[model samples]
Target chain A: DAGVTQSPTHLIKTRGQHVTLRCSPISGHKSVSWYQQVLGQGPQFIFQYYEKEERGRGNFPDRFSARQFPNYSSELNVNALLLGDSALYLCASSQGRTQYFGPGTRLLVL
Target chain B: GQQVMQIPQYQHVQEGEDFTTYCNSSTTLSNIQWYKQRPGGHPVFLIQLVKSGEVKKQKRLTFQFGEAKKNSSLHITATQTTDVGTYFCAGHGDNNDMRFGAGTRLTVKP
Candidate 1:
Protein backbone atom coordinates (compact mmCIF):
# COMPACT_ATOMS: atom_id res chain seq x y z
CA ASP A 1 0.00 0.00 0.00
CA ALA A 2 1.04 3.57 -0.52
CA GLY A 3 2.81 5.23 2.42
CA VAL A 4 1.85 8.51 4.05
CA THR A 5 2.00 11.36 1.53
CA GLN A 6 2.57 15.11 1.89
CA SER A 7 2.08 17.92 -0.56
CA PRO A 8 4.16 20.84 -1.79
CA THR A 9 7.40 18.92 -1.55
CA HIS A 10 9.17 22.29 -1.43
CA LEU A 11 8.16 25.93 -1.12
CA ILE A 12 9.55 29.41 -0.58
CA LYS A 13 7.71 32.13 1.27
CA THR A 14 8.61 35.52 2.68
CA ARG A 15 8.40 36.48 6.32
CA GLY A 16 4.97 37.45 7.67
CA GLN A 17 3.25 35.38 4.98
CA HIS A 18 0.97 32.43 5.56
CA VAL A 19 1.54 28.85 4.44
CA THR A 20 -0.45 25.65 4.53
CA LEU A 21 0.96 22.16 4.25
CA ARG A 22 -1.12 19.08 3.58
CA CYS A 23 -0.74 15.40 4.42
CA SER A 24 -2.60 12.21 3.58
CA PRO A 25 -2.11 9.29 5.87
CA ILE A 26 -1.64 5.69 4.87
CA SER A 27 -4.63 3.52 4.20
CA GLY A 28 -6.44 2.44 7.39
CA HIS A 29 -4.57 4.87 9.65
CA LYS A 30 -6.58 6.99 12.10
CA SER A 31 -4.12 9.27 13.91
CA VAL A 32 -2.05 12.05 12.34
CA SER A 33 0.73 14.05 13.97
CA TRP A 34 2.84 16.99 12.87
CA TYR A 35 6.51 17.70 13.53
CA GLN A 36 9.09 20.33 12.63
CA GLN A 37 12.74 19.59 11.96
CA VAL A 38 15.19 22.45 11.66
CA LEU A 39 18.53 22.02 10.02
CA GLY A 40 20.80 19.64 11.95
CA GLN A 41 18.21 18.94 14.63
CA GLY A 42 15.76 16.19 15.45
CA PRO A 43 12.10 16.60 14.70
CA GLN A 44 9.98 18.29 17.35
CA PHE A 45 6.34 17.35 17.76
CA ILE A 46 3.79 20.05 17.02
CA PHE A 47 0.33 18.56 17.19
CA GLN A 48 -1.59 15.31 17.06
CA TYR A 49 -5.17 14.60 16.04
CA TYR A 50 -7.25 11.46 16.39
CA GLU A 51 -10.74 11.00 14.99
CA LYS A 52 -10.96 14.68 14.07
CA GLU A 53 -10.23 15.80 17.63
CA GLU A 54 -7.18 17.50 19.07
CA ARG A 55 -5.56 14.78 21.12
CA GLY A 56 -2.26 16.47 21.90
CA ARG A 57 -0.17 19.54 21.19
CA GLY A 58 3.49 20.37 21.56
CA ASN A 59 5.45 23.45 22.57
CA PHE A 60 4.70 25.42 19.44
CA PRO A 61 3.19 28.88 19.56
CA ASP A 62 -0.31 30.02 18.59
CA ARG A 63 0.99 30.95 15.14
CA PHE A 64 0.89 27.26 14.27
CA SER A 65 -2.30 25.28 13.95
CA ALA A 66 -3.44 21.98 12.48
CA ARG A 67 -6.62 20.08 11.84
CA GLN A 68 -7.41 16.54 10.80
CA PHE A 69 -10.37 15.75 8.59
CA PRO A 70 -12.86 12.99 9.10
CA ASN A 71 -11.14 11.15 6.28
CA TYR A 72 -7.87 11.27 8.26
CA SER A 73 -6.07 13.81 6.08
CA SER A 74 -4.39 16.75 7.83
CA GLU A 75 -3.32 20.30 7.11
CA LEU A 76 -0.79 22.42 8.98
CA ASN A 77 -1.12 26.18 8.90
CA VAL A 78 1.37 28.82 9.91
CA ASN A 79 0.33 32.46 10.08
CA ALA A 80 2.66 35.43 10.00
CA LEU A 81 5.54 33.09 9.63
CA LEU A 82 9.05 33.88 10.74
CA LEU A 83 12.40 33.00 9.26
CA GLY A 84 12.91 30.51 12.04
CA ASP A 85 9.87 28.63 10.77
CA SER A 86 11.78 27.46 7.76
CA ALA A 87 12.13 23.75 8.26
CA LEU A 88 10.98 20.34 7.10
CA TYR A 89 7.47 19.80 8.41
CA LEU A 90 6.78 16.11 8.80
CA CYS A 91 3.45 14.32 9.00
CA ALA A 92 3.07 10.93 10.61
CA SER A 93 0.17 8.51 10.93
CA SER A 94 -0.42 5.76 13.42
CA GLN A 95 -3.06 3.50 14.93
CA GLY A 96 -2.21 4.05 18.60
CA ARG A 97 1.05 2.23 17.97
CA THR A 98 4.03 2.76 15.72
CA GLN A 99 3.90 5.82 13.52
CA TYR A 100 4.77 5.97 9.81
CA PHE A 101 6.13 9.28 8.53
CA GLY A 102 5.55 11.11 5.28
CA PRO A 103 8.11 12.59 2.91
CA GLY A 104 7.50 16.04 4.53
CA THR A 105 7.04 19.57 3.22
CA ARG A 106 10.21 21.61 2.96
CA LEU A 107 9.32 25.23 3.67
CA LEU A 108 11.83 28.02 3.35
CA VAL A 109 10.85 31.39 4.79
CA LEU A 110 13.00 34.21 3.54
CA GLY B 1 10.72 18.63 29.37
CA GLN B 2 13.03 17.13 26.83
CA GLN B 3 13.13 13.45 27.60
CA VAL B 4 15.28 11.81 24.99
CA MET B 5 18.96 12.42 24.18
CA GLN B 6 21.46 10.75 21.85
CA ILE B 7 25.22 10.83 22.35
CA PRO B 8 28.06 11.42 19.88
CA GLN B 9 26.45 14.01 17.63
CA TYR B 10 28.27 12.49 14.66
CA GLN B 11 30.28 9.41 13.76
CA HIS B 12 32.51 8.70 10.81
CA VAL B 13 33.57 5.18 9.96
CA GLN B 14 35.56 3.50 7.24
CA GLU B 15 33.50 1.12 5.20
CA GLY B 16 33.51 -2.24 7.01
CA GLU B 17 34.11 -0.63 10.43
CA ASP B 18 31.72 -0.97 13.35
CA PHE B 19 29.65 1.94 14.75
CA THR B 20 27.25 2.42 17.60
CA THR B 21 24.88 5.15 18.81
CA TYR B 22 23.26 5.57 22.19
CA CYS B 23 19.94 7.04 23.34
CA ASN B 24 18.97 7.90 26.89
CA SER B 25 15.76 9.09 28.46
CA SER B 26 15.25 11.10 31.61
CA THR B 27 12.22 9.01 32.47
CA THR B 28 11.03 5.52 31.74
CA LEU B 29 9.49 5.02 28.33
CA SER B 30 6.80 2.62 27.27
CA ASN B 31 8.25 2.07 23.82
CA ILE B 32 11.02 3.35 21.59
CA GLN B 33 11.33 3.59 17.83
CA TRP B 34 14.24 4.13 15.46
CA TYR B 35 14.36 5.87 12.10
CA LYS B 36 16.98 6.56 9.46
CA GLN B 37 17.00 9.76 7.39
CA ARG B 38 19.23 9.96 4.39
CA PRO B 39 20.68 13.30 3.39
CA GLY B 40 17.88 15.39 1.87
CA GLY B 41 15.42 12.49 2.29
CA HIS B 42 12.56 11.89 4.68
CA PRO B 43 12.81 9.71 7.72
CA VAL B 44 12.13 5.99 7.33
CA PHE B 45 11.16 3.80 10.24
CA LEU B 46 13.69 1.11 11.00
CA ILE B 47 12.42 -0.70 14.12
CA GLN B 48 10.47 -0.45 17.36
CA LEU B 49 11.38 -2.00 20.69
CA VAL B 50 8.52 -2.33 23.18
CA LYS B 51 9.59 -4.70 25.88
CA SER B 52 12.32 -3.86 28.35
CA GLY B 53 15.66 -5.48 27.69
CA GLU B 54 14.54 -6.55 24.26
CA VAL B 55 17.14 -7.17 21.57
CA LYS B 56 16.46 -7.36 17.88
CA LYS B 57 18.76 -7.77 14.91
CA GLN B 58 18.40 -7.06 11.23
CA LYS B 59 21.28 -8.07 9.02
CA ARG B 60 24.34 -6.15 10.23
CA LEU B 61 22.35 -3.93 12.63
CA THR B 62 21.52 -4.82 16.21
CA PHE B 63 19.14 -2.85 18.48
CA GLN B 64 18.98 -3.16 22.23
CA PHE B 65 16.64 -1.71 24.86
CA GLY B 66 17.85 -1.32 28.40
CA GLU B 67 16.21 -3.08 31.32
CA ALA B 68 15.41 0.25 32.96
CA LYS B 69 13.49 1.30 29.88
CA LYS B 70 15.45 4.56 29.91
CA ASN B 71 18.21 3.72 27.44
CA SER B 72 18.66 2.14 24.01
CA SER B 73 21.48 1.45 21.59
CA LEU B 74 22.00 0.69 17.92
CA HIS B 75 25.13 -1.02 16.66
CA ILE B 76 26.13 -1.69 13.09
CA THR B 77 28.65 -4.35 12.22
CA ALA B 78 30.92 -3.97 9.19
CA THR B 79 29.09 -0.90 8.00
CA GLN B 80 28.72 -0.09 4.33
CA THR B 81 28.50 3.23 2.52
CA THR B 82 24.78 2.67 2.27
CA ASP B 83 24.58 3.11 6.04
CA VAL B 84 25.34 6.81 5.83
CA GLY B 85 22.48 8.76 7.38
CA THR B 86 21.16 10.14 10.64
CA TYR B 87 19.77 7.63 13.11
CA PHE B 88 17.09 8.94 15.47
CA CYS B 89 15.61 7.27 18.50
CA ALA B 90 12.18 8.41 19.63
CA GLY B 91 10.45 7.53 22.86
CA HIS B 92 6.74 7.39 23.59
CA GLY B 93 5.57 8.00 27.09
CA ASP B 94 2.33 6.90 28.75
CA ASN B 95 0.34 9.53 26.88
CA ASN B 96 1.67 8.43 23.48
CA ASP B 97 3.25 11.77 22.61
CA MET B 98 6.54 10.94 20.94
CA ARG B 99 9.74 12.85 21.69
CA PHE B 100 12.80 12.33 19.52
CA GLY B 101 16.47 12.65 20.27
CA ALA B 102 18.90 14.93 18.43
CA GLY B 103 20.08 11.88 16.41
CA THR B 104 23.51 10.55 15.53
CA ARG B 105 24.76 11.25 12.04
CA LEU B 106 26.83 8.45 10.56
CA THR B 107 29.20 8.77 7.63
CA VAL B 108 30.71 5.70 6.04
CA LYS B 109 33.65 6.52 3.80
CA PRO B 110 34.92 4.10 1.19
Candidate 2:
Protein backbone atom coordinates (compact mmCIF):
# COMPACT_ATOMS: atom_id res chain seq x y z
CA ASP A 1 0.00 0.00 0.00
CA ALA A 2 1.12 3.52 -0.69
CA GLY A 3 2.20 5.68 2.23
CA VAL A 4 1.80 9.41 2.74
CA THR A 5 2.89 11.58 -0.18
CA GLN A 6 4.17 15.18 -0.09
CA SER A 7 4.51 17.60 -2.93
CA PRO A 8 7.21 20.04 -4.05
CA THR A 9 10.12 18.03 -2.74
CA HIS A 10 12.13 21.23 -2.57
CA LEU A 11 11.24 24.92 -2.58
CA ILE A 12 13.06 28.20 -2.26
CA LYS A 13 11.57 31.57 -1.39
CA THR A 14 12.65 34.95 -0.15
CA ARG A 15 11.90 36.26 3.27
CA GLY A 16 8.34 37.54 3.67
CA GLN A 17 7.12 35.26 0.88
CA HIS A 18 4.47 32.66 1.33
CA VAL A 19 4.71 28.93 0.67
CA THR A 20 2.30 26.05 0.54
CA LEU A 21 3.11 22.33 0.90
CA ARG A 22 0.67 19.59 0.09
CA CYS A 23 0.27 16.07 1.35
CA SER A 24 -1.88 13.10 0.41
CA PRO A 25 -2.43 10.58 3.12
CA ILE A 26 -2.52 6.87 2.62
CA SER A 27 -5.71 5.28 1.39
CA GLY A 28 -8.25 4.74 4.18
CA HIS A 29 -6.34 7.04 6.55
CA LYS A 30 -8.24 9.84 8.23
CA SER A 31 -5.68 11.78 10.20
CA VAL A 32 -3.06 14.11 8.75
CA SER A 33 -0.47 16.09 10.68
CA TRP A 34 2.21 18.59 9.76
CA TYR A 35 5.67 18.95 11.26
CA GLN A 36 8.78 21.06 10.79
CA GLN A 37 12.26 19.62 11.12
CA VAL A 38 15.28 21.84 11.17
CA LEU A 39 18.63 20.49 10.16
CA GLY A 40 20.11 18.20 12.81
CA GLN A 41 16.92 18.21 14.83
CA GLY A 42 13.74 16.21 15.16
CA PRO A 43 10.37 17.25 13.81
CA GLN A 44 8.18 19.63 15.74
CA PHE A 45 4.43 19.28 15.43
CA ILE A 46 2.60 22.00 13.56
CA PHE A 47 -1.01 20.98 13.06
CA GLN A 48 -3.24 17.97 12.84
CA TYR A 49 -6.51 17.52 11.01
CA TYR A 50 -9.02 14.73 11.24
CA GLU A 51 -12.37 14.61 9.44
CA LYS A 52 -11.73 18.04 7.97
CA GLU A 53 -11.45 19.63 11.39
CA GLU A 54 -8.45 20.98 13.25
CA ARG A 55 -7.83 18.47 15.99
CA GLY A 56 -4.50 19.71 17.35
CA ARG A 57 -1.93 22.46 16.97
CA GLY A 58 1.68 22.95 17.98
CA ASN A 59 3.59 25.92 19.38
CA PHE A 60 4.04 27.54 16.01
CA PRO A 61 2.77 31.01 15.23
CA ASP A 62 -0.35 32.04 13.36
CA ARG A 63 1.64 32.42 10.17
CA PHE A 64 1.42 28.65 9.93
CA SER A 65 -1.92 27.20 8.93
CA ALA A 66 -3.19 23.89 7.57
CA ARG A 67 -6.31 22.25 6.26
CA GLN A 68 -7.47 18.73 5.64
CA PHE A 69 -9.49 17.76 2.61
CA PRO A 70 -12.34 15.32 2.58
CA ASN A 71 -10.07 12.70 1.13
CA TYR A 72 -7.73 12.99 4.12
CA SER A 73 -5.20 15.04 2.20
CA SER A 74 -3.57 18.05 3.86
CA GLU A 75 -1.93 21.35 2.99
CA LEU A 76 0.46 23.37 5.11
CA ASN A 77 0.71 27.05 4.36
CA VAL A 78 3.23 29.41 5.88
CA ASN A 79 2.92 33.16 5.41
CA ALA A 80 5.45 35.90 6.01
CA LEU A 81 8.22 33.42 5.98
CA LEU A 82 11.40 34.16 7.87
CA LEU A 83 14.92 32.85 7.51
CA GLY A 84 14.29 30.61 10.49
CA ASP A 85 11.54 28.92 8.48
CA SER A 86 14.07 27.04 6.44
CA ALA A 87 13.43 23.41 7.25
CA LEU A 88 11.83 20.22 6.05
CA TYR A 89 8.05 20.14 6.20
CA LEU A 90 6.82 16.66 6.92
CA CYS A 91 3.35 15.19 6.69
CA ALA A 92 2.22 12.16 8.61
CA SER A 93 -0.94 10.09 8.23
CA SER A 94 -2.44 7.91 10.86
CA GLN A 95 -5.45 5.72 11.47
CA GLY A 96 -6.25 4.48 14.99
CA ARG A 97 -2.49 4.31 15.69
CA THR A 98 0.82 4.17 13.87
CA GLN A 99 1.66 7.27 11.89
CA TYR A 100 3.30 6.96 8.51
CA PHE A 101 5.35 9.90 7.23
CA GLY A 102 5.96 11.42 3.83
CA PRO A 103 9.32 12.25 2.35
CA GLY A 104 8.74 15.94 3.22
CA THR A 105 9.22 19.26 1.44
CA ARG A 106 12.44 21.08 1.99
CA LEU A 107 11.70 24.80 2.19
CA LEU A 108 14.47 27.34 2.24
CA VAL A 109 13.77 30.98 2.94
CA LEU A 110 16.57 33.28 1.96
CA GLY B 1 2.33 22.82 25.01
CA GLN B 2 3.99 19.54 25.82
CA GLN B 3 7.72 19.04 25.46
CA VAL B 4 9.70 15.90 24.76
CA MET B 5 13.39 16.01 25.54
CA GLN B 6 15.91 13.47 24.29
CA ILE B 7 19.58 12.96 25.01
CA PRO B 8 22.38 12.86 24.17
CA GLN B 9 22.13 14.89 20.99
CA TYR B 10 24.61 12.68 19.14
CA GLN B 11 26.36 9.35 19.49
CA HIS B 12 29.12 7.50 17.66
CA VAL B 13 29.79 3.87 18.23
CA GLN B 14 31.73 0.98 16.75
CA GLU B 15 29.77 -1.22 14.39
CA GLY B 16 29.51 -4.02 16.91
CA GLU B 17 28.89 -1.87 19.97
CA ASP B 18 25.58 -1.14 21.72
CA PHE B 19 23.78 2.17 21.96
CA THR B 20 20.87 3.66 23.83
CA THR B 21 18.84 6.85 23.68
CA TYR B 22 16.49 8.23 26.28
CA CYS B 23 13.40 10.41 25.97
CA ASN B 24 11.55 12.37 28.60
CA SER B 25 8.26 14.24 28.43
CA SER B 26 7.22 17.31 30.37
CA THR B 27 3.80 15.82 30.95
CA THR B 28 2.27 12.38 31.08
CA LEU B 29 1.68 10.89 27.68
CA SER B 30 -1.01 8.55 26.46
CA ASN B 31 1.41 6.85 24.13
CA ILE B 32 4.99 7.09 22.98
CA GLN B 33 6.21 6.48 19.46
CA TRP B 34 9.69 5.93 18.12
CA TYR B 35 10.97 6.84 14.68
CA LYS B 36 14.24 6.62 12.81
CA GLN B 37 15.38 8.94 10.05
CA ARG B 38 18.44 8.46 7.98
CA PRO B 39 20.47 11.45 6.99
CA GLY B 40 18.58 13.49 4.38
CA GLY B 41 15.57 11.19 4.64
CA HIS B 42 12.15 11.17 6.20
CA PRO B 43 11.30 9.87 9.63
CA VAL B 44 10.02 6.31 9.56
CA PHE B 45 7.94 4.74 12.25
CA LEU B 46 9.76 2.05 14.19
CA ILE B 47 7.47 1.25 17.13
CA GLN B 48 4.91 2.58 19.57
CA LEU B 49 4.48 2.00 23.29
CA VAL B 50 1.09 2.46 24.95
CA LYS B 51 0.87 0.72 28.27
CA SER B 52 2.76 1.93 31.30
CA GLY B 53 6.07 0.19 31.83
CA GLU B 54 5.60 -1.54 28.53
CA VAL B 55 8.50 -3.13 26.70
CA LYS B 56 8.73 -4.37 23.16
CA LYS B 57 11.56 -5.89 21.21
CA GLN B 58 12.09 -5.93 17.48
CA LYS B 59 15.09 -7.83 16.20
CA ARG B 60 18.11 -6.23 17.89
CA LEU B 61 16.12 -3.17 19.04
CA THR B 62 14.36 -2.83 22.35
CA PHE B 63 11.79 -0.15 23.25
CA GLN B 64 10.62 0.72 26.70
CA PHE B 65 8.05 3.12 28.17
CA GLY B 66 8.24 4.21 31.75
CA GLU B 67 5.53 3.30 34.23
CA ALA B 68 4.57 6.94 34.64
CA LYS B 69 4.26 7.38 30.91
CA LYS B 70 6.69 10.27 31.16
CA ASN B 71 9.74 8.67 29.62
CA SER B 72 10.87 6.15 27.07
CA SER B 73 14.06 4.60 25.72
CA LEU B 74 15.39 2.82 22.67
CA HIS B 75 18.29 0.43 22.87
CA ILE B 76 20.14 -1.17 20.02
CA THR B 77 22.41 -4.19 20.27
CA ALA B 78 25.34 -4.75 17.93
CA THR B 79 24.90 -1.64 15.92
CA GLN B 80 25.41 -1.98 12.23
CA THR B 81 26.06 0.37 9.34
CA THR B 82 22.34 0.43 8.66
CA ASP B 83 21.78 1.77 12.17
CA VAL B 84 23.28 5.13 11.38
CA GLY B 85 20.40 7.56 11.70
CA THR B 86 18.58 9.91 14.03
CA TYR B 87 16.27 8.32 16.56
CA PHE B 88 13.29 10.34 17.74
CA CYS B 89 10.77 9.78 20.48
CA ALA B 90 7.32 11.28 20.14
CA GLY B 91 4.76 11.61 22.89
CA HIS B 92 1.02 12.00 22.47
CA GLY B 93 -0.54 14.07 25.17
CA ASP B 94 -4.13 14.11 26.42
CA ASN B 95 -4.98 16.72 23.82
CA ASN B 96 -3.97 14.44 20.94
CA ASP B 97 -0.97 16.49 19.94
CA MET B 98 2.18 14.51 19.35
CA ARG B 99 5.38 16.30 20.34
CA PHE B 100 8.74 14.99 19.16
CA GLY B 101 11.97 15.31 21.02
CA ALA B 102 15.16 16.67 19.56
CA GLY B 103 16.44 13.38 18.20
CA THR B 104 19.69 11.62 18.92
CA ARG B 105 21.81 11.15 15.85
CA LEU B 106 23.73 7.89 15.81
CA THR B 107 26.80 7.15 13.78
CA VAL B 108 28.30 3.70 13.42
CA LYS B 109 31.96 3.35 12.50
CA PRO B 110 33.09 0.13 10.94
Error of 2 at B29 (Å): 1.4
- Candidate of highest lDDT: 1
Docking class of 2: high
Q: Which one is best on DockQ?
A: 2
CA displacement after TM-score superposition, residue A82 of candidate 1 (Å): 0.5
- Measured against the true chain A, the candidates' chain A TM-scores are 0.98, 0.98
User: Model 1 over residues A9-70: C-alpha lDDT tens digits?
Assistant: 99999999999999999999999999999999999999999999988888889999999998
Question: What is the Cα-based lDDT of residue B49 in candidate 1?
Answer: 96
Q: Residues A14-109, candidate 2, lDDT per residue (tens digit)?
A: 999999999999999999999999998888889889999999888899999999888888899999999999999999999976899999999999
Expressed as tens digits, the lDDT of each residue in B1-110 for candidate 1 is: 64899988999999999999999999998888999999998788899999999999999999999999999999999999999999999997545578999999999999
Cα lDDT of model 2 by residue, B40-97, tens digit = 9999999999999999999999999999999999999999999999999998865677
